[model samples]
Target: MAVDLEPLDQALETAHLPALSAALVHLTGETSWLRPEWRPTYTPLSRGETGVPEAEQAKMRAAAKAAITAYLTGKAPMAAIPSPEVLHQMMNFVAGADIPEGYGDFLTDELAIDGHSTKDPNWSTPELKAAARKLNVLVVGAGMSGLLAAIRLTQAGVPFEIVDKNPDVGGTWLENTYPGCRVDSSNHIYSYSFEPNHFWPQHFSTQPVLLDYFRGVAGRYDLKKKVRFETVVEEMAWDEARSVWKVRLKTPSGIEHVEANAVITAVGQLNRPRFPDIKGRESFRGPSFHSAEWRHDVDLTGKRVAVIGTGASAFQFVPEIVGKVASLSVFQRTPPWGFPVPHYHEDVPEGMNWLMEHVPFYDKWYRFWMFWMVTDGLLPMVTADPDWTGPTTAVSQLNLGFREMIAAAIAAQAPDRPDLVAKIIPTYPPGGKRALLDNGVWLDALKRDNVELVTDAISEVTASGIVTADGQARDFDVIIYGTGFHASKFLWPMKIKGRQGADLHETWAGDPRAYLGMTTPGFPNLFMIYGPNTNIVVNGSIVFFSECSVRYILGCLKLLAQTGAAAMEPKREVHDAFNIRVDEGNRLMAWGAPQVTSWYKNEAGRVTQNWPFALVDYWRATLAPDPKDFILTKSAELVE
Candidate 1:
C-alpha cells in the first residue's frame, strides 16, 4: 500500500551527489551534510567535483554503491520505517525548517504516497456509502488536474463524468506543439507523486513526451472511459431548489444538459493564449499565429520570422528556429531573468538510467530531492524584506543574491557586448516574473547574424511584417506571438450562476478570488483546481499545487457525503477573509512589488494568479475542510 521503494533505491545506487546527499539526510534524519567518505563527486556550486583524488573518489563511490545495494537486495524496507521519522527526514532535507503541524496529514492526503491505498476520510466510512452513491460529480477539463480528480473519484467509488474541449487528455500539452516546446519544470518531480516515471529521456521533457505521458496516465487510471472527449462545459448553474448543479455541455454532436450533485472545475490557467492588442494586427498578411497554435506545415527555411514577446515560450523556440530561418526579429516588452542551467537540454546519462532501473527507491529519493530543492529552496528569496531599501534591483537581500546570479549568467552570454547585457538584464526583482532556465542558448541565438533582438514597441503591423516605434518596417513571412495567457481571468467565458442567480463573472468583475482557491461563496457544491491565488511563482511545481487543490476538493466531497448535505459553500466572510490574507501575503512577496508589472495581477493591480506562501502553508490550509467556515444545508432525507 505504500509508495514502492524501487525508484528511491535506484537513485541511491546511481550516487547522484545531490540526490544521494538529500536521500541520506531524509532516510537517516541527519541534519549534517554527507560525510566526505560517502559524498558523491558533485555539489551545487561546483559541477563535476570528480576532481577528488582517485583513491578517495573510488572509496566514496564504492561505499555509496554498497549502501544502496543493500536496500535493493531486500536488506532494508524503507517504507516500513515510521511516519514520524520520515517527517524528520523531510525536515532535515529542507534544511531543518520546522515541520508544520498539518504536514503529516498533508503527506498522506496530498502526497498520497501509499499508491492509492489511502481513501478520502469521508468515503472510507461505511455510513456514507448510500449518500456517496447518490453523488454525481461533473469534472470540467480532462487535463492534468481533471485526470487526478477522475482517478480519485473512481477510487472513492463515486460516479463522475469529465468533459474536455480537447480531443485528447493532454489539454495544454496537446494544444502547444510549437518548435522547441517543452516543460520548464523538472520531469521527474513534475509528475504525479504516486505514478513516478523514472525513464524520462530528458530532465526537461519536450512537449510530445509530456503529451504521451498524460495520455499514458489517463490510460493507466482508466480515466478515458469517464471522459467525454471534444466536449466543453458551456455553462453550469447551481439549482438551489434541487441542490444540484445543472451543467450545459457542448459536445461534438450537440449541446447536452446534465445534473450533478457536485462540480469540479479543473480547467487550468495556461490554456488560453493572450494575443497582444496591437494596431494593425488584422493587417498582418503573413501566416501569423500564437506560439500555442503553431503551424508546423509552414516551412520557415529562408523565411524572415518575426517573433513577438520574449517570454518563456519565446525563450525556448527562438534558439531552435534561429539557425533554420533566414532572418529573425525578436520583439521584447521586458527582458526576463535567466537562470543558467548548464544541462538544460542534455539527455539523461546512461549511468543514471541504469541506477533508476536497477537501484531500489532511487527514483523516489531523487524525486524527493528535486521536490525539496525547487519547492522550498527558492521561497526565501521571493519573500519581501521590509527594511531592505533596494527597489529597482530586488525586493530583499536573498532576492538580490538571485538577481546577481542571474545577471552574471546574462553577462556570461554576451561578455563583449555590454549593450546587449543592459538590454537583456531585467530591472525588476528576480521572481517578480518567471525566471527562465537558460544555458546561453538564448544569447547565442540573439548573437546570430540572422537574428535581431528588437526592444522597440510595435508601432503597427504591416501587410508583410511589423512596424516598430523606431519607425522601421521589417518584412517577414511569418509572425509568432509568445505573449503568454490571460492568467488572471479565471474560468473565463464560462457562464456560471449560483444562489440568487449570482453570475460568477459579475461577482468577481474580472478579479477572481476563491476560498483556499477551491470554493467561492454562493457557489454551492462547486470546487476548483488551479483556481485564483493558487499559481506558484517563486517555489514548487504547478502539478504539486494541483494535487493540493484536488485533495482539498476531495475533502469537501467527503464532508458533503458524510453529512448527507444537500449543499455546502464557503461562508462569504470566510471567503473574503481568506482572500484578504492572500492579498496581505502577496504584499510581502516580490511578485507584489510596486514597480513590477506582469500577468500575475489583474487590471485593478490585485495579485490574482499566484500563491504567496510556502508550499507547506498551502498544504496545511487544505489538509481538511473546516466545517465552521462553510454553510451546509442538510438534505431532506437526512433531516427526516
Candidate 2:
C-alpha cells in the first residue's frame, strides 16, 4: 500500500497534538506559523484522493487558532511532543510535492549575495595570488575532492597543485563504469551545494551524468590546469629542518621532488576494491571481475553466472542482469536491511520542479525537510534499546519494527521460497550497517527458476566450476565479486611519512584514526578529507561533510597566510582528547555494540569509521578552525 494522508492523520491522533503544537511554537519562536492546516481535519482520510474537506475546514482553523493563542498568551505546555511521526509525515508530503524549474538559479543568486558563491566579492583574483605567495598546498587524488580544493585555493588566491595516479579526474565515477551503475543519492544533494546542477536527467543520476558534472565543475573553475593527472605522490615527509613537506612523486615519465607548506589528501576510501580470498580464486578459468571493473564484452545471455557477495553494488546489478542470464548463483554473506522507498524510480513532476525553482523558500524548506528526515530524524534509531524483547539481533524497538516491515515485503515477493527468506533475513540490527532501498525488484529476481541462492562458504574455484563447502559444484561462465571495499583501512597501498619518518600505515597498525577525521599530530600541515570517523552513518549528504572539511582546510590556509606560519598541526594532547571524546560517543551507538561486526568497526573492535553525532553538531564544530588545538610555528622560528 502506498503511503498517504490517512497514516498521517492516524499518527497525529496517536500522538499528543497539544504538546506538539506547544513544542513547535517554542522551537520556532513563532506561534502563528505553528498552526495546523485548516482544510485537513484530525480525522483519517482515504487513499488516492484529496483528503481535505471544506465542511471541517472552519473547525480545523479554529483549533489551530486556539493553540496559537494559548501559546502566545504564555499558557503553552512544558511537555515535549510524545512522538515525531506527524511531523515526519508532514515532511514526506512536502518532499513528495513538485520542485519548480530554475530552482538552482534562484539558490545561486541568493548565495551570491551572501558571499558564498564562486563569483563572490571575497573571491577576487588578488586574494588567490596573496594566498599562493604565503601557502603552498598539496592536493591528493585529482577527483572531486582535488578539483574542489584547486577551485577553492584559486578563488582564495592560494597556490596549489592536484596530484592523481589516474589520468582522469572523476574518482569512483571514473573507475566504476559497470552496466546499470548509478548514484543512489539524489542528484540534487550529490552535486556540490555551491555548484548545483540544473540539468540532471534523472532524479537518481547515473554514473555518466555524475562524471559529466565533475568534468564540468573542473572546467568551470579552471582547475584542470593545476591538476597533474597520472602523477602519484609516493611519500610525503614532514621536514623538521625546513618546516615543509618533502613530497616524492612519480610520473609515467620520471620522478620529481616538491616542497609544500600544506597537503590535502582527498583520495577517499572507496577507491580500492576488496576481493574475498577464496581458497582457489586463482583457478577460475571462465572470467572473473569485480563489479567496479565490469567487463561488458562478455555477454550474459544464456550464460551461467556466479555472483559473490550481496552488498550495495550487487543489489543494483543483480536485478539488471537477472533476466538476461540463463542461470545465476548468488553467494550470501550477510543480509542488508531493505527499506521501502516509493520514489526510488519515480520521476519528479514538472509542477514539483516548478515549485522548487520559482517558489521562494520552498527549495530551502525541502532541503531542510530531507536533512531532518535522513539525519536528525533517523539518527535516534541507531541506538540500542536495553529493554526491547522482540529480537536481540535488532538494535532497538523501532529498528525491530523496520525489520518486520522488510520481512513482510520479502515474504510478499517470494511466497514459495521460505528457505530463501531464512537465508536473507538479517540477524543483526536494522541500522547496524548500511540500509538499502527496495523497489520490489530484487526478491522477484531471486524467485526466478534459474536463480540459486547459496549460503555455503565457497571452498574452491575449480577449472570448470565453483565448489562450495557442502561439496556441491556449480558451473559458471562468469564470476562477479561485489565484495565491497576495505572501508576501515582508510588509506591503503599509499605510504605516507610524517615527523621522524614514521610510516602512516605503521602508526595506524591496520586501524586508522584521526583527530576530527581531518588531521594527525605528527603530520604537520597535512589534512585528510573524508578521513576515518568522518563518515555519516545516519541520514545526511557526504557532500555536506566534504564542504565542512573544505571550510576548515580553508581556515587553516587563511591562518598560515595571516601569520606566515611555516607549519601547523593539531597538538598531540588535543588530538588524544578529541579521540577519547569520539570513542566515548561511539560507546553509546549501535556500531560500538559488542555483537555487531560491521565494517564501521575495525578488527580491534574500535569504531574507527562512523561519526557518532548529528550533522548539525559536526557543522558547528568545524565551522572554523581552533588555533588553540594546533601547534603553530612562525616562518623565522626553527624547531629543536
Candidate 3:
C-alpha cells in the first residue's frame, strides 16, 4: 500500500512538538530528536507547550515528518523498548522537567510506552484457566471501572457478571445528563489506558461524548451481554464457610439472590448526590433536583433558576444555562478555584487528530505528556512545608505559588467586577477543594446581567424560594443543586457484610479506610474500585486510579490461584499500618489543613476520599499483590 507522506507536512505543523520529538525516537529509531532545543518549557498547569522558537519547532517538525515518513514508507524500523535510563531521559524531555528520582520505571509502565495495558491480566495456563473457571466474580456497576473489570475478567478467561442501577453502561456519565457536564481532565489521559481514542473531539469531552466512549468500549469488549442493566445490588453477605458472597440483587422484575466467589464493587463514591441539609429543604415546591439528576424535561428557558453550589458541575452547567435563564442566583457555600484552560472545551485540531492516528508513537507520547504534567500536581500544592508561614489559602511557599498564580488568573476573569472577584476567590487553599477547568466562560456566566453570586449562608427554603441568612428571600421557578456527591460514603445504601457478619459501613463508621483503596481488612474476595482515598484531585483522572485498582484486584486473584486459598483479605495489621501511612500523608497535604473543608473529608474531619500521594506511587503499589500482606482462608472444598 502506498503511503501518504504529503499530508504529514501539514499534520506535523500541528503536532505537540515535545510528543512529536519523543515519538520520532521510536518511529525512526534515532536519538537526535532528544536534543535540548526540542524539549518543552516546564510551565505549571499547562500541557507540554514547547517554548522553543517557531524556527526550532519547524526544524523539529520537519525532522519528525521525515522520521515518521521513513517509517511509513518502510525505510526505518520501529525501535525496541528503550532502556530504563533512556525512558528516564525521554520522560524529562517530554515533561520539560527532571522527573523525581526513582520514577523512571513507574512512569514508563504507567505511560505504557510500548502500547500494552500493564493492568490486563494474562491467565494463559490451562491450570490458571481452570482456576479462573472455578471463581465467578460479581462486579457491581457497569460504569468505567466495572466495565474495565468485565473486560479484564473476560480477557483472563474468568467468568463474571456486571450489574448497574442505570439502564446502560457509563456510571456517572450515563446518569449525569446535565446541560454542560464534561470532564475536567484532558480526555486523552482521562480515558482507559488500554483504549486510547485518538479521535476524541474535545480535549475535555462532554458527558455524551464520554458516555459514547464508554459505550463503545463496552460494545468492543462485548461486555453488555454479561451485564444486568437496571439492576441494583441490594445486599451482599459473605458466607464464611463457603467463602462466597451471597448477593441479593433488585432487578426490574423483583429481588433475586445469587452467589459469587468474589465481588468487585465498582460502584463509585460520587454516585449518590449529597443535597445540603438546609432548613426546609423539601419545602421548596419549585421543581428542584440535584445536578447529577438534571431535569432535562423541565424547561429552564427564561425562568428564574437557582443553582445551589459552585463546584465542578455548576462551573460547567451554569455557563450553558445562564443565557437561557431569566435570572440565575448561584448559591455558593465556598467558591471553587478555577484553573485557566483555554482549550477545556475546544475540539482537537483535525491535523493533531490525524497525527495521533498516523504517527507511530505520537498518541502514546501525547497521552504520557498529559499524564505526567498532572502526575505529581499535588506534591507541591498539598505537601505542607514545615518552615513556611502563609495565609489559610496557602499552607506552604510552593502551595502559595500555585494559589497565587491560579488566583491571579481567576481574578483576571472578572477584572471589571471587584465585587464578583471578592466573592469568587476562595479563602481556603487551592488543593483544599476540587479545582475546575475554566475557558473564561465561567466568569462570563457569573458576570451576566441576570446572574447573581450569593455568598451569604442559606438560612432556609420556602415553598417557592430560598431564604438567605441576611433575611433575603429569593424566588425561583427551578432549583438546581450542584452540591457535590456523598463521596465520603464508600458503599452506602447497599448492604455489604464481611466475615463474621461484620457490616462494611458500620465497620468504617463514616471513616472508610481500605488498603490501597481496594481491599479492606475483613472483606475477603471483596474489592472496591474507586474505594476510599482513591479519588484524585490535581493528580490525574479517576480512570487511572480505577485501572490501578482493577489491576491490583487481578493480582490479588492471581495470588489466590497460586495459594489455593478460598479467599484473601489484607491482614489487619497491614491494613491498619497502610492506612496510618495514608492518613499521615494526607495530614501533610494541603487538603488536610484544619481550616479548609471539602468533600475530600468526612463528617469526622478525616480526609477519606483522596489519594494523598503521587499517581505513580499508587501505580507502583498496585502492580502486584503481596501474599505476605494478606490472610488466605482455605475453603471447605479446598480443605477437604
Candidate 4:
C-alpha cells in the first residue's frame, strides 16, 4: 500500500525548514527553489554583497517546489540527486533558508561514504559465508565493540558467543555512575552508523541516555541471548595440537572450558582507573574513591570536598558539586585546553526533535553534519605548527587561533581572578591534550566564594585533611580521584598465551603493538578492536573505528574460509613496519612536541593511544585486510 503524503507535508510545515529545504535541493539539483531559471555558480562572494543571482529567483522557486513534489510523490529517489557539485550548492541554499536554532549549516562532507560500495565485485560474500559457517568464534567484553562484532557476525551468518566480566552489558557506562556523568562526543556521531539514533535529548548525551541506548540496541538485536554475563575469561591458551583457542572461564559456580576457532579481544582501554599514589593515603580517614566508582552514599551537603585530577570526568563533576559542598578545592595536575562550545547544555528543541522523528532525511543529514564537525573538519587544528612564533604556546597557525579564542573567553569570564587565569591557561599548543568544552558554567562555579582552585601538588593526606607541597594543610571530608584510566596499558589483567606458550605481556614488553591495531604476529586466530594506536584522539568516533575494525576482521574470516585455513596471524615484518609508520606519524603531530605532556603518549614517549590521520584514512586502511599481511596456516591433516 502507498503511504499518504498529506501528513508528511503537514509534519514538514513545523519541521526544520532549512534542513527540509536542503533535502529538497539535494533531491532536485534546482537552485530555482530560490531563483528559478538561474543555475548556481561557485564564485567567491565579495564583501557586503549576496552572491545569489536575483534575475532567476522566480524560476528557482518553482523548480524547488517541483523537486520537492517529485521527491515526496516517489517520482525520485535520494540517490538520484544531481551531480555532487550541484547537490552541494543546493545544500548551501537550504542552509541559508529559515532554519531552527541548532540547524545552522549543512555539513555533508563528514559522511563516511568513502566511495567504497558495500556491493563491490571484489567482496567475496559467498566464500566468506562458507568460512564463517565452519568456525566457532569467541568475543570478549560485551561493550560497544563486542556488541557490534556480534551483530556483524550474526548478519554474516557466523557462529559466535559474547562474554563479559560485568553482570550486565554497557561496559564503562554500566560502571561509571558519577554526578553529571555524560559523553563529550556529539550523540549523532557517537552511535553506530547501522543503528543511527534519532531520540538523543541533547547534543552531548548524558551517561544514562547512552547506557539506555546500548541496552535498547542489545535487546532489539537479540544479542543478550548469546552473551554470558558475570563470567570472566581467566586465561586463553592456543592449543597447537587441535589448532584451536582453549579458553578458561571462571563463573561464580566453577571453572569451565570453551574451544573456539577464533577469538576477538574487545576489552576496551577505559575500563580500569589509575589512582594517584598519594603518601599517607591509607592513613587518612576521609572517604576516597575514583570518579568512575562514585559512592553516592557519601553526603556532600555543607561538607568539605577535595577533587584531585582535572581530566574530563573532573571537569563535569566539579561544577555539579560546587554549589552543594560547604567548601570545594580542585587540585589541578595540568589544565586542559578549553574549546569554545556554545550549545553544550542547550536542550534540543521540540520542533527539531519532531522534525528528526517525522521527516525522512532530517536525522541522517543532522548526523552527517555532526560527523563532519566533530571528526573530519577538526583534524587540521590538531596538527602541530612548525612556523608558529611561540614555542610555549600553540604549535601552528590554526592551533594558535583556537588558543587565542579560548584565552579571550577565559579572560572574559574570570575578570577578577588574574591568578586563576595564569594557572588555568595552558602553556602547550591547542589540541596537545583532550580538548574540553565549557559554557562559562565551570568558570562561574569556580568563582563562588566557597570554591578554591588548588595548583600545588599534594604532599600527603593527613587524618583530617590534605597537605600541599608548600606545607599548607586544608581539611576536607571527602576526596574524589578523577585521575582517568590506565589507557596506555592496552589489554591489562588478562593472561593470554599465544603460539608456543608466548605470553602477550612478555611479547609486547609493557608496550603493546599490533598490525593495523587489529592483529598481532604471534596471536593466531586472535583479533583486537580499539587496540594500540587505534584510539581516535583528534578526528573520529570510536563507533566508526570499531565498525572499520569489524569489516577488516570479517575480511580475514572470509580469507580463511576460502583457503580452508585453520588460523591466520599477521607476519612479524608486517607488524613491525606498521608500527614504524605509526611512530613516525605520531612524532610529527602535536602530541610529540617537547613542550606538551599528554596521556595519549606513554612513559616511553611513544603514542600508543591515537591514530594520527583523519578518520577517512583509517576507514580506507582497514576497509579490507591485505592478503599479503597475514600468515595462513592449514590444519595438519590438510598439510599431510
* Tens-digit lDDT track of model 4 for 574-598: 8999999988877667776767777
Task: Report every candidate's CA lDDT.
Answer: 0.78, 0.70, 0.85, 0.75
Q: TM-scores of all models?
A: 0.91, 0.82, 0.97, 0.87
Give the TM-score (vs. native) of candidate 1. 0.91
**Ranking 1 against 3 by TM-score, winner:** 3
Using lDDT as the measure, what is the rank order of every candidate, best first?
Answer: 3, 1, 4, 2
- Cα lDDT of model 1 by residue, 93-112, tens digit: 43323545545555544444
Supply candidate 3's per-residue lDDT for 521: 84
Candidate 3 lDDT, 70-93, residue by residue in tens: 788888878887777777788789
Candidate 2 residue-wise lDDT, 415-504, digit = tens = 778888888878887667777767777777788899998988889888877999999988889999999888877777777888889898
Candidates 3 and 4, the one with greater lDDT = 3
What global local distance difference test value does model 1 have? 0.78
Winner by TM-score: 3
